[model samples]
Target: MAVITKYVVERSGVEKMTFTSKAEADAYDKMLDTADALQVLLSASNQLTDEAQAEALALYLAQQKEPLLVALGVKKAAKAGKQDSEEQTTAKQDDTSSKGLKAVAAGHAA
Candidate 1:
């Protein structure tokens, strides 16, 4: 039998995802953590209709964090040394542009 290796991301003892590459698994896990933190922040807002809406908004914020950061003045431009080169920035935006909130939360590139 051949050997197979996989990186699994688990939450609360339950496997949430499996990836062929460790990087992919790690990234997905990080995204989840971000969403959870955002959820807590949203909770303090007291404006969310319910937990479901809070969770959705949190995930969307996590998935679109890069642009959101820039728009919020939290991330500086490449010329200011906070980002990569212009071409790399363009490519990253292009890759994420097609993905919806769910696709990005799943660590997928559309």
Candidate 2:
């Protein structure tokens, strides 16, 4: 009964796909900005230096941001599922109370 939402990221002529909770989406965007900075540093260097390797590692982490967001979505879904069950229980209790009140008004219950 729960609906999943999809988000898309377009960068460097490639379209990236992701699904995430709102918080995760925001975090991923911030991480992506950091990744972009690393990319710029990597491009400016002509040699495969230590700095370039470090930048590459940062870029890899950035690419993983989307997967991390998806993991967040899984956790969110579990929490949301529990919340939905609680809401349903409350609704059923309300219905039962209403039915009892109607029966009492009609002299069907003491």
Q: What's the TM-score of each model vs. the native?
A: 0.65, 0.37
> Model 1, range 1-110, lDDT digits (tens) per residue?
98889999998999989999999999999998999999999999999969999999999999888878878998875465634576688887877775656577787553
Which stretches of model 1 miss by more than 4 angstroms? 77-110
Candidate 2 TM-score versus the reference: 0.37
- The clash count for each model shown is 0, 0
**In order, what lDDT does every prediction score?**
0.86, 0.72
Q: Indicate which candidate wins on TM-score.
A: 1
lDDT of 2 by residue, 15-90 (tens): 6546466667666667778887767766676555577576776778677765655576733454677899999999
* Candidate 1 all-Cα RMSD: 17.5
| lDDT leader | 1
How does candidate 1 fare on TM-score?
0.65
Cα RMSDs, all models: 17.5, 10.5
Q: Show the colliding residue pairs in model 1.
A: none
